[model samples]
Target: MIIRIIDGITEFTGKLCAWTLFAVGFFITFEVLMRYVFNAPTIWVDEISRVLQVWVVYLGAAYVLKHREMVTIDVLLSNPNSVWRRLAETLAIIVLFIFAGTACYFGFQLWLKATMAGHTTDTYLAPPKMITHAPVWVGSALLMLQGAAQLYRVWAEPLPSDDVMGGAH
Candidate 1:
């Protein structure tokens, strides 16, 4: 029951992030059209778009990892037995956790420093650097959480087909 709840929550967060990405994309595209065609450029649209892009990429990364969709070279390790595949995937998840954890830690530190320094972008509609870095911190943390869930799933569930596996083609 606990595992199922975690999975559901993670899935919901992923979907929400995806929807946010779509909204941001649509808004940015509309802003661009309005600026070029209607000669009414938005000063803050570019900054907003850039921040949203970061959120989309990082959060989407976590979502993909949870869904076991990230690309990897597992041609040689593709095995029919459930145990071997699960072990290989667990190893892969360990490596991913290490990488994501490091990124999150450093990203959080960067966010902290940016917040302390009170730095803002140089624009007519300037925004804080923390605003940009916040996504990196949040997204990476969620990614780490999803990675933990994936690691659990690899051990709990039966090994899947290579084509449908995380480290597979």
Candidate 2:
């Protein structure tokens, strides 16, 4: 029940954040066209696109994991129903748990500091630093949740199942 809830949340967050890639691409293209054709460069495009990319990475991490699309060595995972595959999966989950915990802790502290001071970006628009920093902690926490669920799944579920993702074409 709880794992399903966590998975549902992960799916929602991942898909929503994944769409930001389109926004990033559109913004960059708009900037290029404005700079070349219109000859009037916009100041916000670069920063906005960069921010969107950061979000896509930070927010979409758990989605990548949930879909089993993360970068892997694949030496052990290639052959299922083996000790090596389970070992690799356990190690990966432990590493991810530690990383997500540390990131969430530090990211929260930094975000708190920035928010308390009412900090803003150094860009021309000077958007709030909280906007970017907030997602770091938020997304890290979500990733941690999904990691726990994945860890449970690794042990609880039967192995040797065919694992194919959405874009398997």
Candidate 3:
């Protein structure tokens, strides 16, 4: 039940991240056109695009993990039926959980500090630093939540017999 909610969020977040990537590309293109063609470059596009790029990475991390797309020892889980595959997935989840949790903790602290200090970027736009720092904790939390769902999935399913991962039976 809870796992379903996490999966739902992960799917939604993935789509959102995809759109964000598009936006990042669009923003960069717009900046390029403005600078090269019109001889005028906006100050905000560089920073905005950079922030969007970072957000895509941080927010998409959980989606990556949920789909088993992150870096891994493909050979270990390649069989998809061996007990070692499940064990490897579990270990990977555990490691991601730890890393995400730690990132969330420190990210939240840093975000709070930036907020309390009323810090802003040094650029002309000078957006609040909290706006940039927010993705760290938010995305880490999502990754941790999705890790739990993946952990559940790894244990609940039975091993396949017919070589579902494209290898011989």
Candidate 4:
């Protein structure tokens, strides 16, 4: 039951991230063509693209971590010996927690500051800075939550092969 829920959430997040990437690409391409061919650059395109890029990155980060696809030097960790492999996995989870925790803390702070400032982007479209920054809270919180969950899975029991290595098979 829990596995199914996680799988659904992970898949949804992945699709969301992919859609965001596509949107960013589309907007940027449109902006380039409009600027070069029409002789009138979009006033808000840059801001919109910037915002989309930020969303793509932070949101994608959580999905990446959830899948354990983030790069690591696994040559040493993938030792043939089970003990060494387990140790390396444990160490990696610990390090990930530390890094994720720190980033979440700071990301929250930045989000709070932006919210308090009540600022918006200086453009004709007047995009809210809060809108741009809102993802920081969502992304960091999700990343932190996923990090804790991963740590628990790492510590409590051996991850199911399908879960740990991904359901590639």
Q: Judged by TM-score, which candidate is best?
A: 3
Candidate 2, residues 106-140, lDDT tens digits: the string is: 99999999999999998898989988898888888
On the 0 to 100 scale, the lDDT of residue 125 in model 1 is 70
Best by lDDT: 3
* Runs off by more than 4 Å, candidate 4: 1-7, 79-81, 152-169
Better of 2 and 4 by TM-score: 2
lDDT of 1 by residue, 1-169 (tens): 7666667767877898788878888888889798999989877777787777887788777778866677866677776455767777888888878888888999999999989999887776778989888887787788778778777777776655656645545
Candidate 3 lDDT, 27-50, residue by residue in tens: 999999999999998998989988
lDDT of 1 at 103: 87
Number of the candidate with higher lDDT, 1 or 3 = 3
Which TM-score value belongs to model 2?
0.88
| Candidate 1 lDDT score at position 115 | 96
TM-scores for the candidates: 0.84, 0.88, 0.89, 0.77
Error of 4 at 58 (Å): 0.9
User: TM-score of model 3 relative to the true fold?
Assistant: 0.89
lDDT of 1 at 104: 90
Q: Compared with the true structure, what per-residue lDDT tens digits does model 4 show for residues 1-169? A: 5644654566677788798778878888898899999977878777877888788777777678777787766555554236666666667777766776777787778778877988777778877677877777677666666665666666566543433355562
lDDT of each: 0.78, 0.84, 0.86, 0.70
